[model samples]
Target chain A: MTSGIRPKRDEETVIAGSCDSENPRRVDGLQLLGEYRGAAYEEPRFLVYRPDGQAVLLTPLLYRVLTHLDGRHSLASVAERVSADHDRAIGPDGVRYLVEQKLEPLGLAVLGAPVEQVPTADPLLSLSARGVLFPARMVRTIARLFAPLHLPAVVAATLGTLLALDLWMFTSGQADAAIRTTVGDPAAMLVGVGLLLVSTLFHECGHAAGCHYGGARPGAIGVGLYVVFPVFYTNVTDAYRLNRAGRLRTDLGGIYFNAVFIVVLGCAYLTSGYAPLLAAAVLVHGQIIQQLMPTLRMDGYYIVADLVGVPNLFGLIGPIVAGLARRGRRGGRHAWRAEINLRPFARRVVIAWVLLVIPFLAGGLAVMLLRAPTYIGIAWRSTAERWTAVEQAFTHGQVATILIDTFATLMLWLPWVGLGFLLARVLQRAVRAGIRAVNRRR
Target chain B: MVEDMTVLEREHVEFLPSREALGGLVNVNIVVPVNLAIAVLGSAALACQNAVGIIR
Candidate 1:
């Protein structure tokens, strides 16, 4: 049945003595079904009829909003009522807008004033929330640049050369002066920091471009924190929706981009002998170390996930932990149980997770425990440092100076243990899943 | 005939096996096409690393 639009009428569609001015209304009428303690009406009582014959089964409070909207009470009064009732500082315009947006489409709500975008509902993952957060805008920008690169062997060879050369320099002790010099110069430091930021942006673009190549739309990119470490994330969630081949492209996108960028950076280093290139090289080297760290939620971890055909290794950890918990509860019940109930592949995988997690978790805990005081002290000092920087900037009118310095500091420390843990958990699951596949085959 | 066709269609769409489904009924967990791409990448990364002399 097609519901056509109905004309608006300017009258208070009042419920007969059902509404109380003292009390509030809920939007959902079914919730208020029991609240009408003394109200009486025919079947389907307390319905405030809209102009289009679409009746809103209002709770007493909602009906008040409708009753007050007589084109006489200003929208402000309505907003205040809603705010008082809902505990949200919903503006008069917001309430009307929300009601209007819902009603106009259904031909139930009539316009009293213009509608605007409502206040954002508080999100679970705040901009501050730690872990794998990607902003959509940055991801889109990245995708545009990422789409042109081909999977040329030369690109890989070039990247390989850069990494080897950097490692060679560090091992040979020839790069120490270069590193020290780059760190000492503020102008050099800024360039190094800028290049690192650009590389990260390129990394996310890799993921987006990979998704595009794989027939998926790359979504939003944003800043997210992995525990205390802040990261830039692009929403390539659509990549997961694609086939395993497509998913791999998305996973490798960042590294592929990194490889190409390093070649360019390396060439610049070779040509100019600039101290900034050395700094950039060091920063790029650090990024490579991070992405290759298979134990964390880095690019390497996602590559493993895609290889293992796991949609979300991180999400699977909770269920795996729960299963372990249940096993612990069973305790000795299975002491003499059939040892070979699971397929060989599944058993091998279970063993792998246990083997991987036990030492990793223990080692991680030990490291945390050992460094806890120092880390805490550093964090406190860092916080103090940030505030100091901000205050000094403000007092001296050098906000840009402080901000640039702060961003540089974040790049240095962002890919530490926090990201390691995230990636570790992901890798553990991927490895276990792979083992499970092998066992199933047997 | 129509009922038989509907039953086949339902089975085709129902990809995953139930926890209660027998092991023999389980199809081989074939590595999807994308997984192959990732393997290629992993090898590529390793190959790139080798070429660059990260590993001798």
Candidate 2:
């Protein structure tokens, strides 16, 4: 979800690094998944990871060139083959220019004309400072094992169970009571929060399982630091291969799993009469709500994206905005076409999304910033109070309260910290952009 | 999406992770609501604890 535009620096990193000249060798051991040749794709998208976890989306013609990357093929040879295959005359210069300017900058392919070391994941497409909880092989196995759950009959039944549980809890006052019980009893709170966290992790598994069922291979399961908090994730990049239906399944997979988690929580609550289990179930409902918000870079956004058959709506925000700004001037009516590559219907949907999201996000961020002091005060006060509770619980040898308070304290404080990091990063980008603009102006 | 049949566009839109190909994206569920939930829940905890009186 990064802007593919790199600064004109001679820096040597793949944040947007590209090489001047070299064969269009797929980065050594590139895990780039191509579509099955038998007849699935007249034009399927290619996912090429940059050094950073972000990747660039390729148009089909570009993807064709990418598919030709065996490292042994010369630029001219590839150009020749792709031209003949697609009935398009993309010369060697066109191939080289595409690789050098577009693909190389992103480190999707190497033109190490004097190409230094090729940047493979060296082993994996990865996150920065990642800790793999389950390796790719294990992830594949898990996905395969759990694939049956995505069967339509099973999904419908699971959703039904969640609906029933939700109705029963809210209608019977079980939800309200569960929250009260969970909060009052330290053990209950501990168990409730613990189950919620586990359920979140299981949500990742749902994505893997869905991807597997949709005929796409999933990658490793791991925890990575996102904006300074630990987040569990499953790599379902290959899910892009599936048609819109398949992609939608992958998008909704996490929520489906959350429902499954809720079923288990409901069953536990029912059998053990555990209020906290039900309480945790309630929290899962909240989490599911958050996940469904198309505003954030979460599942809902992807759902919208997959529904429209556009892989990355976030990427379009820039182009569309620029197109709008340019159109305000004379002779810039068609500016949007240069940036947007989607069909009429898809393009319209993306524009609407961009319009909605820009204001919504901007307003939210502005409010948070303007009211930062107030939020910080609340967060600080809450964190201190939670920490105190932790200390008090420790003094009293109340293990469960100690656990609950400590976790609560962490939750209370991390966002402010994350926000701080967010601000700092934004400021850094602003200043860097300023410098780059100045350099360009000169 | 076929190759923009009319034009041999120079660039390919590389698909980044539709989902995190690399792992551990903590659902923003924790990210957004934890701010409010902890306070709300902690109060509930306190309300519940009023009876037990925190003596232990």
Candidate 3:
């Protein structure tokens, strides 16, 4: 046999050969996070944490081979060790096959190299804002301080407060008045908007706190544009190392924090009889409801994903749809099956989620597109009026008016900017499709 | 004689990966139909409101 690794035709088996002694296959810095027993799946799985905050699940057999890759052992030696330990004849070829097919794809195994450079522009990185704010260490410190609030008693108290606020709103008849007053007064609207912004920041902190509580390291907390709307996101990807319950807690933590903020606002409304505070509380409730929408990559989507033990439910949608189309064309009676990394039950749940989400998303997008021009025009006019007011306030040396006008301008221009972004995205997709068609013809 | 032979056969059996059957009944069968019902009812209600001029 030649003393070099060669790719085999069969996916399950590789051609057994002597590996190079000088350049041994090694697992660089892959952290093995023990085993995870998912409720949906029969087999126990383990997680491999990558340097770039991505986690990959592996079967026990693959994990055993991973433990043997310590930079010193050749592929042959590693296979021998696994065979000795497990009493199964997993030859060097099998080891190489697993490493190349599984581990290498996840960036866990390094073959014939000590270090691999991180990609400068990962597709996921584009979804997030540039640069990190609140590094891991800082997040950990803040999380430690808020750890006490995550206790059972504190959680119960927060839930009680929410119930009380709901009861009060039902009885007092002030809810409608608060909404009307806030809508009528620009100043009140601005105050409510400001409160909403602050509450969103608090919501992100809650996610970080939940991650810490679950014994996972929360990375940066930053602001970025999700589609057109600016949103706060905490890097709680490490929560995948946690069990399903812990992951769910992390997903729901943001909404929990929003509830806490609402309670505080409710108390303020009760004390000062401030209509704007109550209005802001109502707005926060609306925000929580919106976040619970599972159609998008929001908290509810993550919650469902964790519940079903599927990491990338959205990614599976395209394949599932394509498979369905193919099956229909072939006149198959049964639903088309694809190799999505999900259990039977979880797969069913994902299909249901996709079916519900598709129509809702399509309808929402259709409505938005139909009304875009009118909405855009209104936003433009409002922003111009606000800007003119701002200039007048500035010329008159009225600092307070200028601040209010600036806030108003921001509020007005945001919708316009969002519509523009949506238009641009649609056009880009259309252009790409046209280019593909042209290439096909050529 | 038969028991002794069965035991020997069991000892030499090879372990194979489990191939669980993908059952016919899925959660989507129930959920998708129910969601469709809701959508139909909701659109009907909206149409009624619009006809009555209660909604613009």
Candidate 4:
């Protein structure tokens, strides 16, 4: 249904000049969802929703043209309508081009019969999450239960708890002793690891709750192998529809949950003097810090991206680096412009982040590479010894020893499994590249 | 379709130069750097403790 707003007849005549007789083209199942002014761009952007669960941003002019595509008007007439409404000269050719190139890609319109699919390869192989474990309904329920924790009173409590915990750690040597004992005691270390995993799950829940609080629907929670590490991930992509604060809350929600967990642990330690809980709190702190490392797409990187109002900032690294190289080669006098979809300030921030990240990542990778052999050797020896122990226990019919040894053996081999996955991924990419090259030649 | 239109009408539209954007800049410039510093100092302290056999 049209909004019932129409332009003046004289304005329509000027816009429809000599091209309003073509076949009317209509947008199939396209819906104008909403509009938002982006921090990165000057123009107000409209979200056009397709029936296929996908949404794309369009400029106001394009949106105006789209609104007129009710199958009752031809492309020329649509152009005329938009031009009349906006008091500008938008020709039929411009309308045709926009419909064919822009709208067609988004599956927003039927330009004719469907085009043949081209087999194109993506240069990057993204590790996608396996499946949704916690569905949207379950997530929403959980999010509601924890929504009150985001209140001002809870915020004050969190701050108080942090200060108290810091004071405790500063005054007493118990934290250090607890950490040392936890590290040396295998049983304690295992329990601590379990606690950390639970905390990580809660961290993801925190993200979901924040999205819910921000009026965005939280999707599924799933696990994926990010690089070599199997990590938990939550689908908060609907947070994209939200403004900057909403998205930032979702990004920082995990760490906020970590803080809440620490507060509970700190209170427990104060009351019971159980140092291992404090030690677990320390480990959670380490995890939080690790997540803050912006080299990888973790909380810290998302925070940066959200702050600059850019999505998929990592994907822009290639073009930004290339733009820098091009600038250097041109003697750095003229301004180098790369076709990056970012505001000027955002572009600068991204360039700075890339420069900082590249060195940090390279240094970290170099260290890991240098220590790989020693690490692998240690793991192999440990796993072999554990396996032998397990075998001996099995023969002796020592059930407890067998179980313990089996667990130990599996723990030792986990790194090897991760390495194998990494190698397989690399080999798969190489094979795909070779096949593509051969096909290109053919 | 009527329900969808109602939802769209209720959507909150904020213009650019949003408070969220400014807050994000502060977070990246100030908060992240402070966190990074804390991590570096903590690592150094841990390394020192390890060297002195305090952690062993």
How would the docking of model 4 be graded? incorrect
Residue clash pairs of candidate 3: none
lDDT of 3 by residue, A1-442 (tens): 0111112234322212233553345444557787754445444566666554445556667778888887688778988887777644676767766666555534567663322332111121023232355777898898777766778899999999899888888688888899777655545655766787788777877888888898988877765544444456677877777888787878888889888898999999999998989987887876787677676667887888778876556656676777666765654423344244456788689889989877876675666567666655655665565566556656766554456556544444443354456567567656866987999999
Candidate 2 structure quality by residue, lDDT tens digits, A394-420: 788888776766666665665556556
The CAPRI classification for model 2 reads as acceptable
- Sorted by lDDT (best first), the order is 2, 3, 4, 1
TM-score winner between candidates 1 and 3: 3
Looking at model 1, residue A308 earns an lDDT score of 50
Candidate 4 chain A lDDT trough over 10 residues, lowest sum: A1-10
Q: Could you say which candidate leads in TM-score?
A: 2
Superposed on all Cα atoms, model 2 deviates from the true structure by an RMSD in Å of 5.5
lDDT of each: 0.47, 0.67, 0.60, 0.58
**After superposing candidate 3, which stretches have Cα over 4 Å from the reference?**
A1-25, A36-39, A42-45, A84-89, A113-133, A183-185, A328-338, A362-374, A395-401, A411-442, B1-56
Sort order, TM-score high to low: 2, 3, 4, 1
Using lDDT as the measure, the top candidate is 2
Q: Each candidate: fraction of true contacts kept?
A: 0.00, 0.34, 0.00, 0.00
Off by over 4 Å in 1: A1-144, A153-174, A318-347, A354-374, A381-442, B1-56
